[model samples]
Target: MKAAVANTFDSILKIEDIAKPKIEPHQILVKIHACGVCHTDLHACHGDWPVKPTLPLIPGHEGVGEVVEVGSAVTHIKNGDRVGIPWLYSACGHCEYCLSGRESLCLSQENAGYSVNGGYAEYCAAHADYVVKVPEGLNYVDAAPLFCAGVTTYKALKVSEAKPGDWVAIFGIGGLGHLAVQYAIAMGLRVVAVDTGNAKRELAMSLGAEYYLDFKTDDIVADIISKTSGVHASVCTAVSKVGFRQSYDVVRRGGKCVLVGLPPEDMPLPIFNTVLNGVSVVGSIVGTRKDLEECLEFVARGKVKAIIEEKKLEDINEIFADMEKGEITGRIVVSI
Candidate 1:
């Protein structure tokens, strides 16, 4: 099989021929069709995150493909089933978090691209238990981003506790933020998109955002408070220290602020104001299987859709460069 392998930190991925992976008794062999290039994949290549991935690792978790073969012990899924593989590849079923159906928080969790071989190849192996069945009408390329970006934003909204007609501000209009805007609108909440420049503002409004605030030129805190009478909740999809702090000022007293982006290790929040206003600052990781299923259903029901850019597998390195510079909008899907 041919795969784009990450050989070293701060280096481009190398395409190489490697031995086809053998599946375990509980795993399935998927013929890779498409994989989404994510910010985390770029971070892994640059060694931004704490985990030092193994050399020559295949770094992609937002994968969609058809099942070519299933292990002998696998029963729920079979050959020819289309599935989407996400970051959470496996979790210890006996852990307390998993026992409570919060497998995303399992202490013993194995990430797909970070801890093991992932997509970005002709074929890949995945644990059957964590694989999500893609809807029949969606193409593999379109469904790729839903594995991570869509599910992440969807889960963040679910935990926000905002209801219809409430104001929900999404900070950042990039890949994840764009999806967050659509999801918020579908859930009947009025969305306020915060990002710099006219381009992002236009994009956000086109996606059903009621208001778009140019963070660079406008007083965002005042605009949000005035527009919606104070935001009910805010989802921070862009990882900026300043943006995180701004969320607290716009939200109503006792409102929720959720963090979905991976900020710097030493980033600090305004502890004094957080406690004084009775506001809750929550951190959300990727979704569980149940969350992923609900996300897919949202897509299937036309409640949400992913904005994507499609590229060939050979352009993986170029895609990363653009993503790092914030040159790409929406999610980038690599066709295998």
Candidate 2:
């Protein structure tokens, strides 16, 4: 099997011929057709987070393809079923968090592309119980990003608790934020897209966002407040400290702020303002298995679609470079 392997942190991923992964009794083998490149992949390759990924890693969590073989113990999933190997690889099913439907918080959880090898190769092994069935109508390239960027943003909006017709602001109209705008529209919420540059503004408006604010040229906080008297909820998908602060500041009284982006800095909250306004701050990670199913259904029904750029697997390094420079728009799916 051919794979892009990261042998060390802050080093370029090299394409190398490696031995194919053999499945365990509880695992299945997926012949990866397409895999979405995420910013987190760059972080994983660079060892950016406190909980570092294992060395000699194949970093990709949005891998989708056909099941070539099934484990002996796996019954529900069979060969030829199209499925996606997502971020939440596997979790201890009996844990408190898993029992309560918050499986992403399970203390004993394995993450694809982080704790273990993921779908960044010609063939990848996945836990049968954790892989999600890709909708029959969704394309492999399109369905790939839905496994991560799509599900993550949709789960963030769900946690925000903003009702239909309520105002919701999406910070950073990039890979995650672009999908967030479409999801908000489909869910009947008015969307305020916050980001700089005319290109992002046009993209947001095209996705049905009600308002587009350029953080670089416009007073986003003031503009949102003046129009909607503060949004009912703010979903911050930006990787900047200022974006996080503005996300918190633009929420209406009693509204919530959902943080999704993994910025490398602590977000400071105003204690007095939070108490007085009864505002809530939340940190939402990747989605659970159920969340992935629900979010994918939206795509299958034509309610949501990921704006993706397709590239070959050999272009992985250039993709990472573009991600670090913030030059890529939407999501990039590598055709394996």
Candidate 3:
């Protein structure tokens, strides 16, 4: 099998022929059709986070493929089934968080593209219990981003507790934020889309955002406060310190702020104001398997669409460069 291998931190991936992976008794071998290149992949390649991936790794978590082989212990899935391998590789099912359906917070968890070999190759093995079945009508390329970007934002909104007709602000308007706007509208919330460009503003408006504010020019905090008397909830998918502050700023008293973007440094928050306002700040990672399923079902039902550009696996290195430079819009799916 051919793969784009990350040999070291801050280095371009080298395409090479590698041996196919073997499945464990609880795993399944998938012949990959598509994989989404996430910013998390670039962060992994650069060793931006405290923990780093093992060298010579295959870094891709949003993988969609057809099951070619299943281990003897797997019974819920079979050959020829289309499935997705998300960031949450597997979790200890008996843990406290897992038992309560908050499995994404499970302490004993494995992450694909981070701790183990992932889906940048032609073949990869995934735990059968963690692989989500892709819906019949959703495009494989589109379904790729839903595994990570889609599910992450979806879970954040779900945890935000914003009610119908309530004001919800979505920061970033890019890959995940674009999907976030659609899902917010489908969930009956009025959306305030935040970004810094005309293209993103137009995209957000087309996707049903009730208001669009350019963070670069307009007074983002003031405009949001004036529009809906402060948003009932805010979801941040852009990793900007200033944006994080603004997201916290535009929330009404007793509102919620869900953090999804990963910034390298800690955010300097106003402790006194937060306490006085009774606002809650929460960190949401990727979603559980059930959350991934619900996120994809929104796509399958034609309520949301992942804006994606497809490229061949050979262009993985260039795609990473574009991602680092913040030049690409929406999500890019690499065909394996």
Candidate 4:
């Protein structure tokens, strides 16, 4: 099988032939169709993540493909079933977190594309218990990003506890932020999109945002408060320190602020201000299989769609370069 292998940190990916993995008793082999290139993949490639991925690793978790072969013990999924592989692959089922239906926070968990070989290849293997069944109506390329971006944003909104007619602000209208806008609209919440450029502002409005604010050109904190009375909750999809601080200011007293992006380990928080505002700060990771399934249904029903740029597998290096410079919008899907 040919794959995009990251041989070193901050280096270009090398296309090379590697042995195709054999299916384990509890796993199934999928013929890779498409994989979404996420910011986390770039973090891994540049060694920005806490754990250093193994050198020559294949980095891609948002994958959609057909089941080509199944292990002897796998009965839930059979040959020809289409599935989506996400970041949360599997966890120790007996852990305290897993027992409480919070598998995303399991202490003993394995991440696809980070701790193991991922979907930047011709084929990949995934545990049957963690794979999500992609709906037949959703296209493979578009469905790939939903595994990560869609599920993450959906989970964040669900955890916010805000209802319809509430004002929900999304910080940074990029790949994840764009999806957040669509989900908020479908959920009947009034959304305010915040970013630094005119293009992103326009893109967010086209996707049904009630208001768009270019953070660079306007006072976002005042603008949001004046328009929505006060933000009920805010999701910070961009992990910059400034963005995190801005979220704290715009949300109303007692409002919830969810952090979905993985920023640097040393990132500091404004403890005094957050405490005075009576704000609740929450951290959200990739969601469970059920969440991914619900996200797929949303897309299949035409309630949400992942805007994407498709490229061949061989252009992996070029795509990484563009993503690093923040040159791409929405999500980038690689056809494997």
Candidate 5:
């Protein structure tokens, strides 16, 4: 099997021939056809987070492909079925969180591309219980990003608890935020798209954002408050601390601010104001398997679509460079 292996955190990923993964009785072997290159993959390669991925890792979780073989214990899925391996690789099913439908918070959870080997290879051994079935009409390249970027944003929006016709602001119009904008609209919430560049501004508005606020130019906090009396909720998908602060500031009293982007810096809150205003600040990680199914259904019904640029597996290094430079406008999916 061919894979792009990150031999060290300091160097670029190298394309190398590696032994294929062997599956357990509860797992299935998938022939990866396409994988989305997420920002988390770059963080994994550079060991940016406190919890570093083990070195010599194959980093990719938004891998969508066909099941080539099924293990003896796997019954629901079989050969030739298309499925996607998302971030939540597996979790202890008996944990309190898992039993209550909060499986992503399970203490004993194992994340794909982080705690274990993931896609970015020709083949992957996935737990049969976790991999989601891709709908019949969706393209592999298109369905690839829905595994991560799509599900993450949709779950964040659900956590925000913003009702239909309520004003909801989406911070950052990049890979995740772009999809967030579409999902917000589909869920009946009005959108206020926040970002810097004019290109993103256009993208957001074209996707049905009621207003597009440039964080660099417009006074986001004042402008949103003046026009809409503060948003009912704010979903921050930006990687900057300033974006987090602005996301909090633009929310209405008694509204929630859902944090999805994982910035390394700490965001300090005003305890007095937070308590007095009854505002909620919550951190939402990747979605559960059920969330993945619902979000993909949105795509299958033609309600949401990711703007992706396809690249070959060999161009993984260049894609990381572009990601670091903030040069790419949307999600990038690698064809395996």
Candidate 6:
């Protein structure tokens, strides 16, 4: 099994011929077809979070593959089923969060590419119940990003509580943001796409965003207010402190501001106005299994799509550098 192994923090990922993973009684072995490159993969390589990923880790979560082998206990899934191994690897099913449909909050959860080995390889294993079944209509490359980037944005919009005919601002028109724009439009919300460059602005408009704003050229706060008297809700999908600020500041009174991006540094909040305006600031992590299913269904139904570029699995390190430099226009899917 050829896998991109992360041996040390702040080091380049090495492509090594490692032994293939063995499945447990409730697990399945997948022959990976495509794995999406997420910023979290870069963070895992660099050990950015407080908790470190297990050394010699395979860093990827958005993996779409064909099930080559199913464990003895696996009944619902079988050989030849195309499945996606997502971020939420497995959660303790008896936990309150899991029982209540919020399994992403489970304390005893194992995450792909973090606590366990994940997709940046030719073969990967996952708990049968945890992986999502990819719809037949979705392409392997397109389905790869939906496992993470697509579901993350879809869940964030759900958390925002933005309704049909409402205005929703998507801050940062990148991987997740681009998908967010499409999801918002499909849900019947008017979208205001926010970013710096002309290319991103144009991409947003082409993807059905009702308006576009370049933060470098225009006062985004004022421009948003002028168009809709502030959006009904906002989702911050960028990691910058300033981006978070803009996401929070542009929401209408009593509206929701959902934060999806994870930045190492914290952003300062304005207490007085936040209280006076009755704005709700919330953090939305990756989606649960059900959310992942719905997100994939949206793609299958042609309501949304991930604009992706396919790359070889060996270029994993270069993809990380591109992400760090903010050069990727959309999501990148690595074909293994």
Candidate 5 TM-score to native = 0.99
For model 4, residues 83-157, the per-residue Cα lDDT tens digits are: 988998789989889898899999888888988889999999999899999898888998999999999999899
For candidate 4, which ten residues in a row score worst on lDDT?
A: 261-270
User: Per-residue lDDT tens digits of candidate 1, residues 1-336?
Assistant: 989999898999998999999999999999999999999998877887666878778999998899999999999999999998899999999988999988999988988888888998989999999999999898898899999999999999989999998899999989999999988998899999999988898999999998999888999998888888889999998788888878767889889999888778445767888888889989889899999998888898888888888999999989988887879988999998
lDDT of 5 by residue, 1-336 (tens): 999999999699999999999999999999999999999998898998888988789999999999999999999998999999999999999989999999999999888888888999999989999999999999899999999999999999999999999999999999999999999999999999999888988999999999999988899999999889999999999988999999999898999999999887999999998999999999999899999999999999999999999999999999999999999988999999
Ranking by lDDT: 2, 5, 6, 3, 1, 4
Cα deviation at 280, candidate 6, in Å, is 0.6
lDDT of 3: 0.93
Clashes of each: 0, 0, 0, 0, 0, 0
lDDT on C-alpha atoms for all candidate structures: 0.90, 0.95, 0.93, 0.89, 0.94, 0.93
- Residue range 182-296, candidate 3, lDDT tens digits: 9999899999999987898889999999899999899999999998999999999988999999999999999999999987778988899999999999999989898899999
lDDT of 2 by residue, 39-138 (tens): 8899899998889988999989999999999899999999999999999999999989999999999999999888999889999999999999999889
Taking all chains together, the TM-score of candidate 4 against the true structure is 0.97
Off by over 4 Å in 5: none
**Candidate 4 segments whose C-alpha is farther than 4 A from its true place:** 265-273
Which one wins by lDDT: 4 or 6? 6
